[model samples]
Target: MTEFQAKEMEEQEEQIENEAEDNKEAEDSAPAEEQTGQSEVNEETLRNKEEEIKKLQEEQDELKNRLLRVQADYENYKRRTNEEKIKERKFRAQSLVEEILPVLDNFKRALDVQIESEEAKSLKQGMDMVYRQLTDAMEKEGVKEIEAVGKPFDPHLHQAVMQVENDEYEPNTVVEVLQAGYSLNDRVVRPAMVKVNS
Candidate 1:
């Protein structure tokens, strides 16, 4: 072969090698670009996940607040119910005490009457003792007698049976009490039957 032809063949081989090297470099650069794109997608997914977590936390907080409010409402309802029960008990006690007052007054009237014999006096004393015991029991339960004799005839406390004209006494005055009145806890159970002076 001629030297000129050999030199031309060497130059052609070198050019082919350079072209292969450039192709390899281009393949490596394409993989790096693909990796960068994948990283960007992963970052976007992570940001979306963080935002979802924040929304869930907010929902949890709202539910906790609602639960607290419900608990407070239940507590108030319990307190109110207890207070109502106590009031009902007190009212029932007052009514029961009022019902027993008339029986006690009858005993007092019976004791005030005079006895003719010793046996009768002994029986009367026993009855008086029983009356005292009953009155003591009533007092312990907050029962009391209303004032009626020789006082002004108040419509709230007394029921006037007969009116009498008297210059010695003031008009609308209670001259005598025919039936005693009773009270339970400052509330009148029965008004006194009285004779009023006009």
Candidate 2:
């Protein structure tokens, strides 16, 4: 144990302490670096999740829009079908009324014939009531008679059987209704057989 030996031993101890401190610092910095890397990974994962959510929202919106369009189309289809049903019902009624029109005309002709006997007159009156009831039922179903006599003649509504020179009516006016015209729902079912003024 001389003084030179003691000084060399102290220098060796100081070198070992410095080496331990450096190792401790390296260990601390490694964890901090690891934490930074983990944070970056977490941020990337969060961004991916946000992107996925955005795509899903856009898909949901598209689906909702499509649903609304389909709903609207279905509603329009229902409305059109209902309208067609009403038109079909009107057409059916009109056809039946048209078939019965000849019978009504025959009844009118029979009533017009002169009858003097009491029993025949009574029968005529009963037939007239029946005709009126039939006409009333037809009217309720939107069946109507076309007014031809004394009115301005239209080729669409009247069929001209003949033309006559007359001062009482203007030219092309209907002077006589030889056969009754009929309409259903404002549409002509049968045109009036008419004599028009020349």
Candidate 3:
């Protein structure tokens, strides 16, 4: 071959070798860029999952709080209903006891009259037995007599029928009980008629 043609062939071979090296560098850098992109995608997926977990936890807490509130309200309602029922029962018993007070007063008058007579001894005994039965029934129903005689007079339990001047006891004291007062379960059913010492 000629000298000029041989030199031209050598220069062409050098240019081809430089182009092959550049292509290999580009191929290696492409894999690095793809790895960086994959890492970013994984980070984004983790962040989304964390946010979802946080929201679920908040919702669970709210539901628990609501459940506790409902339970407390139910307990309060039960307590109130039980109290109302007890009050209703007490009121009913008090009303029934008040209705029988007049009969008890009549029995007291009859017993007083019978105890004053000697000829009516047998009749007095029968009347006394009846009085005992009535009083026993009243006691079973939580009825009690208020102490009036010789006690300090109270307008709430005693009605002053008359006032008298007396040196035997303190002034404003109850000296005589004309009609006995009664209470049912600590509530006054009837006020006593009494004489107060002034």
lDDT of 3 by residue, 25-54 (tens): 856865675676655767666776577578
For every model shown, the clashing-pair count is: 0, 0, 0
Worst 10 residues of 2 by lDDT: 30-39
- Please provide, for model 2 over 1-198, each residue's C-alpha lDDT reduced to its tens digit, 9 standing for 90 to 100: 448756865875686578568657856765665666664767666776587679667766965786697689679979999999988987878768889889877877878899999999999999989989988998898888899988999998999999999999988899998888899888898999999999
| Alpha-carbon local distance difference test for all models | 0.77, 0.83, 0.80
lDDT of candidate 1 at residue 28, scale 0 to 100: 75
- Candidate 1, backbone clash total: 0
Whose TM-score is greatest here?
2
Pairs that clash in candidate 1? none
Q: How far is 94's C-alpha from truth in model 2 (Å)?
A: 1.7
Winner of 1 and 2 under TM-score? 2
| Poorest 10 consecutive residues by lDDT, candidate 1 | 30-39
Q: What's the CA error at residue 63 for candidate 3, in Å? A: 2.4
Per-model TM against the reference: 0.56, 0.66, 0.62
lDDT of 1 by residue, 18-123 (tens): 7568657856775675676664767666776577578657756865785687688679879998999977765556767766767776777778887799999999
Greater-lDDT candidate between 1 and 2: 2
